[model samples]
Target chain A: MRLITLPILMLSMFSVSTFAEEHVVSQKNKSFSENKISINVGDTVHFLNKDPFFHNIFSLSDEQYFDLGSYPKDESRSVVFDTPGEIEVECAIHSKMFLLIEVKKSEDN
Target chain B: MKTLLFYFTLLVSQLSYAAETEPTDYTFIAGHPSLQQWLLPTPIPTPKDNPLTAEKVSLGKMLFFDPRLSGDNNMSCATCHNPMLGWSDNLTVARGYKSKALTRATPLIINLAYNNLQMWDGRIKTLEEQALAPMEAELEMHADLSQKIALLSGIDGYVTAFDNAFPDQGVNTKTMAMAIASFERTLISNNSRFDTWVKGDKSALTADEISGFKLFVDPVKGNCAVCHSPPNFTDDGFHNIGLASFGHDNPDLGRYNQRRLNLMKGAFKTPTLRDIALSAPFFHDGSAQTLSDVVEHYSEGGKVKTNLSPNFTANTLTPEEIASIVSFLNALTSPHKPFTLPTLPQ
Candidate 1:
């Protein structure tokens, strides 16, 4: 009974890691699926390139600004959210394609 | 039977090719009409009220070149928008009729057909409306409409053209703007190496040039497409790409001056990078001189931050890569331009 319970605890821990790990903001169908996303400061937001070509994930907004310059099709990038507040993400290639990420302050941090 | 099937497939493919060969309805592409393209969302639509006419366009062309429309002989609409200088005088700040009042001036006409709103502030709605500002502005063309109209009416050529162009409105400001704008409409740029490349011509660009184009369009490399987008090559949206002057003691609060939208504090309309190599000194102020300098500016992000453009991230572009991007920009120039330099009517 003890062994079975230990295995169950480990499985639950694995599931929890999968949930809170790098959250993907995919580029698909010509726009970001969800324009606004919420995440804790420590969590990473992965810019997953699901488009046919490439995408430049960059921003000028003060909350968070970094250009993950062009990544090819099917490539993915992860940025640990060190900064908190409203971060604007945009494709350098597709001007109209823009997104806002609300980076919440991590209670632990 | 197999040969017959192959022939049928060939015939179908040829027919589809023919259908696709029909020129796009985008006016920025010379012969094509601009009603369909521009920045996709901000397409310029003729007021369900004002459709196009060939005669109106012809008349507008004549009016655009005529200096009699100005209050002072020192300036005409063409004075600032000279064809020789890519329709812009290449000044950081435009001079008045006597080169006095220093105001920023951009190109005369770009993808106007696609713009839902006109001018930096989006104040003017129609070409006809935009036509009056220069003539009436104290420091611009500086002309009173009453005298200009009388002068125009006396000219037999102008009278005849106006009579033919607008049976009801004649050569009033609206008709005049319409005619001039129609003429401007004809000044679309196409047939660049980039256009050829887009149409599947493999030999249109060199290796470096192609890579530069890729960088311009790619999200990671140059990321220029965010504002200077494709097809007609303009987004018609506003951004504050951190131009240095924004942080000045007296800051120009760009679009925010109008709407007061927080994000628009230093935001200004995104200029098309199409034919960028030909149009000197980038930005609304005509500040940056060379294309490489322009790239370097973006690479370092914007110079100032007072009301900095939210899109301003320091785009990292290398020197050799910058040269290649410049070459690619040159490739966007139209091989065959529509309008020729007019011998100014003395």
Candidate 2:
């Protein structure tokens, strides 16, 4: 059957290039066990600091603004969430840490 | 005095050190309160999700001295911050909103509770995002924050001060910039006379302001505590002291426009000489209009050296040590309260 329809169209383009959207964003009880979230638009989000001290995530928000400039303690950083709406992220050396991502909209035609 | 305001709020909540280097000098001694050996802790930048109240600091001091939040009700925010001139606006440029001038000038909200960043090109890092950068700038105070919150939600005395100030997240623009940033976080400064001579009070200052506070902590004389440090003088950091004298011609990379690094070219924000002899024509383009021309532009270390700020040029004082570091920076100025003005909500 034509080699099983070309191996089911190459396994649907390898499951849309292994889609992503991860999270952890902690700095130890400084809040953000998901202050707000939603992802899909080429997903990717990871901040993991889990306090022992050292963090700086930063954002000027209008839909994604970066400034990771200093991270230490169980290290991590990804951020692909490709713009959509309602961002509001933070850390800038812990002014009480914060979060809010929500990307959505990318179900492939 | 309540055991000296409980040892000065346990010296500004344990300015505990070891965040590495940077804590230059001045404060925490005599009846000890732990300015953590001269200030550092800062990290309670309050975001465990924006918490701060007192009916959002009394509706952010009536939207910081209302004037219909500007667009020609004739400016407010104490018309360029004027808690009797210590909140700065002694002007060197600032005017606009049709009065016209602005190249930069008008800063001083007092000890921004330990500044991590905000303006003079630190590009807003909260004060509820630096109170909407002078009302949607078109040259300051242009006002249009969603038609000034739909004309202050059709005023009925701002609908009872927005129903006793946010009775559950009311009247928008992020709760009117977190209620004028919770009345600019209680505009804190902590009593001066160099904090009653750092609390020992040996006749609080005057011995040439205690040899200009021992040559402002002599690091080779008036090293001005390596960037106006201690008990909040300012190490809120950012340099490039050279003021590129009034003509400007290129290079204001400051804090490298949010750190692109290049020794933060012609950097800005290092203010806080605390109520700095009443915020007069100083740098960030006010071009040092006198504190002996900003101690002769740091005694000549800034006249432009293409990318200066190696602790900004021309050192080795002596005019009796720049008049004892300008009489110990006029004892770090600050005290002028009595407000009153506001009254527009009708």
Candidate 3:
């Protein structure tokens, strides 16, 4: 019975460790699909450009700074949040395109 | 027969409703509720970092009117952005320091508070950043900010004003910019006949003007609303509207210089149509002499099609429709009122 329980515990731990989440944020009609979102640290955000024009998504936030340079429609760029803090994201070309992400420390961490 | 009639009525009603609400198929019906979004909100947007105050406005007004801000101590901001000429110099292109002609026209300061980006190229992000640009530029105001601060610090009136505006911040370049930007924010326009028409006033515009508004929104017609969006009459986006100057050799690559994007080549920021009638000699190159000329330019789909905006296309508007659109533009200008110049501190 002890041997059986150890195998089950190992399988559960393996599954949990492999489960990193990804969120898709679309740039549609010159606006972000979600203005604000909350995610756990280590979660990756994929920014998909859905508009006809080119979009450059970037964040100058102290918590995480990244510039996903201009890409045409249907293209995407992603970034992983390693730090637990809020990040203000915006499009470099379209000034009005703005988004906020609040990253919390993961339970696993 | 009765069932068929009912279905037709339902279909017509749904189409009308969609046309009213959807910007994609925008249609202008008198006193439509959907048009109210064009009215400028009463509360202006100010950054959390630089919250507006009465002291800041007062100080900013003084700084804006002071020619001493310039290196030569002659030209003030008001020299080019004259309040009498719709906050523009009424020139084909702005004459900079020592009467040197600049490439671009002096954009009107009307409804700038609503703009997401500033300048013809959308280079400056905020008014605070824009306020000091002309003052520091060699061809423009040509003043050394540190030297200007020292001069202002020497003046007792300026020192007291700066102290009141930015307590403990003292007389510095940052405080001066904040103050000037604060004053500039007060230059807003939302009380036009067009605004009144949007606010459910059926009698605000004439029948011709109303017809012109329809053409303005129609995608196949003038389609002016595509770029000259409602409320402030600007999308705050850059576009190469196909001016003749764009065809020239080594033309000014407006937004391209900043972004280096192929689409941005020769593109300039879309100026607000609010009080546009007063800010004559229009376009980034100051090519269009009148509103009629501007309409014709759009109707022709631009002279230089090298990098024309996707929104701009050859429009087949009749002469009457052109006149009507021009008439509609006239309704955008608010009725003039007396403006008292700010008194400069000695």
Best by DockQ: 3
> Which regions of candidate 2 are displaced past 4 Å?
A1-109, B1-53, B58-101, B111-133, B141-143, B146-161, B166-182, B191-193, B202-209, B213-284, B288-293, B297-320, B330-346
Instruction: Sort candidate 3 into its docking category.
Output: incorrect
Q: Rank the candidates by TM-score, best first.
A: 3, 1, 2
Q: Clash pairs of candidate 2?
A: A95-B45, A95-B46, A95-B47, A96-B47, A96-B48, B301-B313, B301-B314
Higher-DockQ candidate of 2 and 3 = 3
Scored by lDDT, model 3 comes in at: 0.82
Measured with C-alpha atoms, the lDDT of residue B260 in candidate 3 is 59
Model 2: per-residue Cα lDDT over A44-80, one tens digit each: 6666554433455767786777876555544546577
- How far out, in Å, is residue B179 in model 3? 0.7
| Sort by DockQ, top down from the best | 3, 1, 2
RMSD of 1: 13.8
Select the stronger candidate by DockQ from 1 and 3.
3
TM-score (C-alpha) between model 1 and the true structure: 0.66
DockQ of each: 0.03, 0.01, 0.07
Worst 10 residues of 3 chain B by lDDT: B10-19
Residue B228 of model 1 has an lDDT of: 67
Can you tell me the DockQ of model 1? 0.03
Q: What would the per-residue lDDT of candidate 3 be over residues B1-346, giving only the tens digit for each residue? A: 4333333433343234323334644446656777876888778888888898999999998899899999899999999999988899889899988889998999999888889988999989899999999999999998998999999999999999998889899999899999999999988878888888877788999999988888887778998886787667776777888888988888999987876556678989988898999989899888888999999889888889987776566788899999999999989898898877777777
